[model samples]
Target: MFLLFSCSGAFSEVVMAREKATGKMVAIKCIPKKALKGKETSIENEIAVLRKIKHENIVALEDIYESSNHLYLIMQLVSGGELFDRIVEKGFYTEMDASRLIRQVLDAVNYLHSMGIVHRDLKPENLLYFSPDDESKIMISDFGLSKMEGTGDVMATACGTPGYVAPEVLAQKPYSKAVDCWSIGVIAYILLCGYPPFYDENDSKLFEQILKADYEFDAPYWDDISDSAKDFISCLMEKDPEKRFTCDQALEHPWIAGDTALCKNIHESVSRQMRKNFAKSKWRVSRRDVIFLYHILPKTNSIAAATLHCHGHPHGD
Candidate 1:
């Protein structure tokens, strides 16, 4: 077992290794058994959920090895880096390019929804490329926050990254697969404008903005963006989860389905803003707050309820 690289997360550490027998490279997720003492069910749930899903856009689980101290999950290696990094590295990005990428994500989400699995956390960081090749496919990863819901069952856990989290989840409401759709909407917004729709140094203020669905295609950034694209985003970002477009509907939207040319180069503005926004402390702050809100607050009803009262916002499935 040759160690390639390692990445640490809140719950587990992922190590890349080469199989001695086949010489195949794989990602090994090292999860400590003690960390999952009370939450062993979640690991089982994740394994069961992943084992059944075999989509081209989803990461595949190859094998599992368990010891008294840790559980090892061997997964397919995705070496193409993150979706955000790829977009920034490109010289000529365009609306059509964004469309193609979104379409692939939507396809994967649609498949998950069909299987009654809700990817509660759907953010750009979770999207990976199969390889460094230009035509590599995007693979959705990190199922730590995902939920496998049964028919008609609604998920009440308010878990997900901030900014990308659905309004309904923050409201402590019973949410469904629409939460993924809302996250996709947020991704789409960033893809078009190169900045998050709801951004603030304060967590409460940011939550308020998200709850109210307060976002716009501001001037200069959105000057060249097509109306069809804006409309597509609007339908997905609808405050009312019921009113938000389903993955099926979003794929059928004119911006995605219509004959609108999407090959224009948007790299100049998008990349510039992406660099500026990421360079600031805003993204870091939002990420920290989101983890706090999702993990800590949800454990206590009083605190969760108090946090939920900080603002009114909209979200969908």
Candidate 2:
């Protein structure tokens, strides 16, 4: 027995539920079978990946059930809300705070990479706080885009959210877990400046910028950011995946390990920009399927565009 709360999003109904047997709380992802047509394999893949992983910073897939009409996924309940929201609510934020957050992500991602898994999508929307506490840890959710390596298949899928996707993914290059590192760089950049590293109103133009790794630490916004912070992001966002920093390398950077990450409060400017730039319907585009259909499909022929529209589409969700 479970009590269904309000639906969380339009794509899938992620409602808060309380288990009657154990009196425990959880999040249940309700997916209608009709919506899963032609997407069974993707759902199976996501389940397999979630089943294999166990990390403190990753949302745990507690259980799964299949009724006559729907597939139910029981997940860890994380109510601390989104990462940006937490930062915006804080009265004092600093480079050190951002670095601490990034460090946790890097540590979790490093664990995933060690297990031959790549989190193809690592955007802000997917990073959630574990609980409604001041010290709540960040938890990485949404494994629909994750791919496990050593499965005798090359990870060449042009997947992941556009603004946060890696350069190679946009270029349709055969990529590695390094793609996750690139995303971390993008996240780190945003954490510091409160905006995306690469952005353009036009989708094609946005892809071009990501393809070229075209981004700048612009003036006023970056004036107060530490040089080490910039360098750390530069290493992760390097155009060449070969040259990009690994999670291990990033963890050792002065910004994360040493004293380079300044303690100066930057909440006013960073939160202001974050609120303006990430307002609803402005930057949180949940149309990864469209990107797959219109852009990635034509460039790479391995994956069919129709199949890419499934609930497992890597762009979001």
Candidate 3:
């Protein structure tokens, strides 16, 4: 089943890699030189925010490199795949399952807030899976749109994926990390249902729906979900920025709030095991490895001569 991982679309530079020795996979998101749009600072900013963050649920920045006019980000790859694909494959999450998944994401975000990194993009594509057997091992990746708190000045760029972009961002307001939390709400809703809460062919109309803050449930599916799940999502989707839950506080909310004693203990044990795994894993590489990638990477938007050796050998990446 091992094959060279490649795909093309908007910003066709992106590619996936699966490490052979460790059976571990990772996504290598290349920032094309021309796509930089006179904004080289974002690459630096993303690196700054990601390097300081470390958590079980958040994808670890494995390495960073630049070369051939492109920047290469070596990230922990989620193998079970993107959450959006899962919804497409299975149609929807069965209430408790969706809640469990979103709750773990809240935990990851809670950790990020502690480090003051707001992941500007928190949609299903960015939420990755480790293995089909290990759903709880999901990790949040993609720090390209991330922002760090108490650093310099607030970012005013009105850039984010249309559907998941928070309304405040579209308003072009100088926004904070809270923008990320709003996106999380959108993800939670999408996971529970088969589709997003709001949909419109007109981007403006979609923005209006988001601003108006109305979610509709048509039939049998919404009626069958739990009040607790609905209430938690409502709490997250609040339009008023002041009332929204910060990541840390969201972790303790009732929907996710269980006695943390067991989860905490289990995570600690898992950490110990992860470190041991890290030591023995054949795919291990230091940040310097990514700097190597930076040197080898091509300058264009396409993945020209991107040897899969970034993962292990010539065939995988």
Supply the global lDDT for candidate 1: 0.76
Off by over 4 Å in 2: 1-11, 287-317
> Candidate 2: lDDT over CA atoms?
0.81
Model 3: lDDT equals 0.60
Identify the runs in model 1 with alpha carbons over 4 angstroms from their true place.
Answer: 1-10, 151-153, 280-317
**Per-prediction TM-score, please?**
0.85, 0.88, 0.71
The most accurate candidate by lDDT is: 2
lDDT of 3 by residue, 260-291 (tens): 21111122222333344333433132111121
Among all windows of 10 consecutive residues in model 1, the one with the lowest summed lDDT is 288-297
If the candidates were sorted by their lDDT against the true structure, best first, what order would they fall in?
A: 2, 1, 3
lDDT string, candidate 1, 192-245, tens digits: 888999988799999999999999889988999988889889999999999999
Q: What do the candidate models score in CA lDDT, each in turn?
A: 0.76, 0.81, 0.60
Clashing pairs in 2: none
Sort by TM-score, best first. Answer: 2, 1, 3
